[model samples]
Structure formats: structure tokens, C-alpha cells
Target: MKKSLELLEFLGEPVSRDMKETLAHGSRQFRMSVHMTRVPSINNVVLYSHWHEELELLFLAKGSALFHIGQEKVTVRSGEVVFIPPNLLHSASRLDQEEIVFYAVLVHFNFLSSLENDQIQQQYILPIFMQNRRYPKLITREMDEELHIYPLLEEIRDAYQQESLGYELLVKAKLLEILYRLQKCAIHADADLDIGESRNSNSLQAKKVLAYVQQNYGKRITLADMAQHVNLSPAYFCRFMKKQFDLSPMDFLNEYRIAEAISLMETTDKKMTEIAELTGFCNVNRFTETFKNFYGCTPAYYRKAIRNHAGDGQHAVRCDTDLKSY
Candidate 1:
């Protein structure tokens, strides 16, 4: 029991702070993680747009959240689950109420694959990973199969937390059952799956724009340059970006920069001016104003709050200021 607790503690370390990548060492072994997450009302914009090479399932146990998956926006309330496919850009924001609690189970397709010559890997798993099949992104308690699958999710979570002898085997079995059910549903609804080609094209273009911003956030970036990079006029580019992310290009850029600034504040003891410049705010005063506007507190106050809570090992910010608009 002591050994199990120690292992759980080791696995709880925060490996990924940025939105661009998720680094889970345990997931590399079994390619799966079942974890609980809480988003305070003040710090509601829990994650920025990011993509990973793992299938993600989110169960909302309490409260609500708005999720942006590619160009589609979904409002997932309590007693709901959302599935995000691998390599899809997604972000989440809390609803305008109390804190939100959710369970996230991330599974990489490689976890289920055997040797290269294995029939299961070649026939069933590879096609799902290759996007040859489509699965419903959201499943609510009202759905017909929820009674069958929700219990499996709970069992998996319980088996994971208990970590008894053969716990891993039990969890894997539950996951396989969930995937089989999802695949069966997908096959039945194959004819109704219509992810238009235009949406796909827009997603690709948005990814290009995101890459540009990520690479050049520290430097001066202009709307004209961004539009030219994607072969669109500036006016049209603004429309395209707003449609894709619900934020104009500049709004998204500022949000990304602020997110980077917050990361620096949490990880480093650098001066606010230095952090501002590094994150592309250019002017210290402007950075403070923008930070306060988005976070509902000055950067100095945020840093101090974080320092005071350092011993507790909890996040300092509790409320999200600008996320409600999205």
C-alpha cells in the first residue's frame, strides 16, 4: 500500500505546463492516464489551444465547460463526456458559475498495439489512428449507451486509483470495452459523419497561423504579414481566424502571450518587465494593464499570491476574467 501511494505521488508531478505539448511519462508506458481536474471560477480558462497525439476522453462530473475542438464549439455540462481525437487542436473554459470538476482519460493508440505483425494492430487499431473511422465527440447521460459506458469509465477510474494486484489488467480491460463500444457506434453512424472538406482546409490553415504565432510571439507580428503567410488578405484572414478560434488574430496572439507570461511567473523569479519583454508585450505598463484585464489582478499581485501558496502547491489564480466572453 505504501509503495502504491509513493508511485501515485511520483506520477502526479506536473510534466506539461504549456498548451503546445503534453508530457506524461506514465502514459509512455501504458499510454493512458485517468486523472481528476478542477477549474476554479476565477481561473476558468484552464487550457489554451493545444494538440497531442493521444485520444482524450473527458467526463464532466460537476459544473460546466465550453470546449473548442477544431472549428466546432461544444458546451459540455455535468454528467457528460467528450472525446477528442488525436492531433486535434482543442481548448477549454469554465462556465460562469462555480468551480468545475472533470475526469480526463487519455489513451494513446500505441498502448493497445502489439508487435508489428500482430493482426489486431494491423486490422483494427491502425485504421482508427489513421482517421479512417469517426467517433461521436460528445456523449451525454441522455444517450442510449451512456448507462453501459459511464459505469465502465467509473470502474476504470476506481481500478486505477486502487492500484491493487492486476489493477493494470483490469483497467486495460475496461478501456478495451469502451473502445469497442465507441467503434461499434461509429460504424453504425458512418453514413451521418460529415466533416466537410472546407472545415478541414480551414483547420489546416489555422494550424499554420498558430505555428506562426508560436514561433514569432516574441517579435513584432503584423496582421498583414500573418495574412500573407497564409495566402489570404488581411480582412479575410481576420474573419477566418475569428471563425476558427472565436478570437481575432490579435486577440488570440495577446491571449497566447499572456499565457506564456503566466508560465514564466509560475516557473521563474524574473522581473515583471523582463517577463513582459520576453513574452512580446514590449512595454511594462501595457503588459500590466493587459495582464490585469485578462486575469483580474496585477502581475505583481499574482506573483505574490503564488508565492504565498507555494507551500500548499496549489495554483494561485482562482478566477478567469476574459474567458467568459468566449
Candidate 2:
């Protein structure tokens, strides 16, 4: 917890919540990126929910979290890794007073394929990306005794940070190594999983909440509107959201909106006021205050710093050690 809080304080706050489903984690060529996500327990802040097309591995280095993955709550403790398949709604936060820190690595499967189809590709790789087999949901420290993939994940983090020439080659090789271990893990652990179980109605409602926010985030949405979309009374809806995400409906919406605003600031030359309106904030002042509240700094300064570090391939600015895997 000391190291986790230090990293959070180093960055002033967690990396601007990239809660959009469509944002690519890294460049298209590499299609792999790592984010040191730290979720503070204060201010009611949590990692907001979103889905993407890239496979995700979250190595929980310190503290534990009650993770909302695909409508179910999973308690991931220290030294465990979370394997989230593409297109699953997932979010995380500290279950108690402690802060949570983890490394989120996203990689598109196509980038990892061989130049030509091979037997290894067919037998070991194709089933995962093609959805024929489900990815394992969790990898515990105890289960990794034989595989040692946790240490490999730490190696991946070190290799990615080196940035030496041809380091991508090492990263790719390690990712494939992890995949092989994951295959073995599936046979051992997920064999008893009920793949065809019916999803809860609450999960369906959660999906609806995500869908509504994604489509309507740029509009003036309210608590009543959010509750109505899920067809629950305002009071019940708030409780449902709290139980599921530990956040109010408007807080979730605001996190989503702020994520969008950060995207716009990075990708566009839009003015602050325009970006505010584009992100569904009623006024620029409100947008600025909320942005500052989330990140302890003004939007203008954040944008200026971003521009200052342009073309360096930074998703967010940090020192190399700030991205510790364990």
C-alpha cells in the first residue's frame, strides 16, 4: 500500500480514466500498451466500466479489489492476475479503505499471430481469439507455481520499459509464452466452468446502463434519465448502482464524460469551451472544476503538458518505475 499510494501521489491522480470502449490502448502496429492504473478509495473514485476489442491482463501487484467483471463481482487479492476477454464490461476499486494498484496490459490478438498459419497457431492460438474457447477469468498466485507466468508478466513489464531496439520482439515472445501458460491453465482450472449459464437480469441491466451512457454521454443526462433508461425507480436505481459499482449514477456518467474530454484534448485542437460542450458539460467552468477535481490540475495545463510531450508515444506521462508490475 505504501508503494501504491506513492505512485498515485507521483502522478497526482490515476491516469485519466480511459473508460471508452473504442480507444486503442497503443499504436496499431504494436497493438500493445501498459497502464499503471491506481484507484484511490477517496472521493468515491473507482475505475469506471468499459469494454474493448483487445485482450486484457491486469496484474494486481498490491492490495485487493472487488472487481466488477461481466456483471459478477470478483475479489482479486494481491499477487493475482485478472484475465478479461475482449468485449467484457470490467471495472475495479478498493473494497475497503486501502488504495488499489495494478498494471493493465492490452494487446490485440492479430498483432500476435504468425506471418503464416501454422500448427501452433491452429492448436494453441486460434481458439482464443475466435471465441471458440473462453479465456480464464482469474490466475491466482498459488496456481502459478508450475507456470511462473506471474514472473513472466513482471518480465514483460521490464522489457516494455527498456525501450531498447528490437524490444518488441522480446515483448511478443513473452506474450506468446504467457498465452501458452494460459492454455495450460484453461485445461486445469476452467474445465468445470459452466459456459452456458444464464446471465443475471442485473447483469443485463448493467449492460443497458453502459450502452445508454456510451450513446448519450454527450447529451445533458440526469439521474432521473439514467434510472428511467433501466426502468427502475430513482431510489432503487441508486442502490443498484452502488451495489454494483460503489458509485452513483451521475458519478459514473461524469467519469465517462471526463474520459471523453481527455480523448478530445489529446486528439483534437478544439478549444476548452467547445470540448466542454462536446463532452456534455453544461459550461466550461463546470468542466474545468470537474476535471481539476479528478486530476488535481487544470485542463489547460494538462493539455499543454500533453502537447509538450507529443510524438513521444506516451498515453500518459510518468517515470519508468511508476509502471511497476509487482
What residue pairs clash in candidate 1, if any at all? 42-318, 42-319, 42-320, 43-318, 43-319, 43-320
lDDT of 1 at 81: 84
- For 209-276, candidate 2 gives per-residue lDDT tens digits of 87788788999899999999999999999998887666799888887788778767767899999999
The top-ranked prediction according to lDDT is 1
Evaluated against the true structure, the overall lDDT of model 1 is: 0.72
Off by over 4 Å in 2: 1-19, 41-44, 187-208, 214-326
TM-scores for all candidates: the values are: 0.80, 0.61
Worst 10 residues of 2 by lDDT: 8-17
Q: What lDDT score is found at residue 276 in candidate 2? A: 98
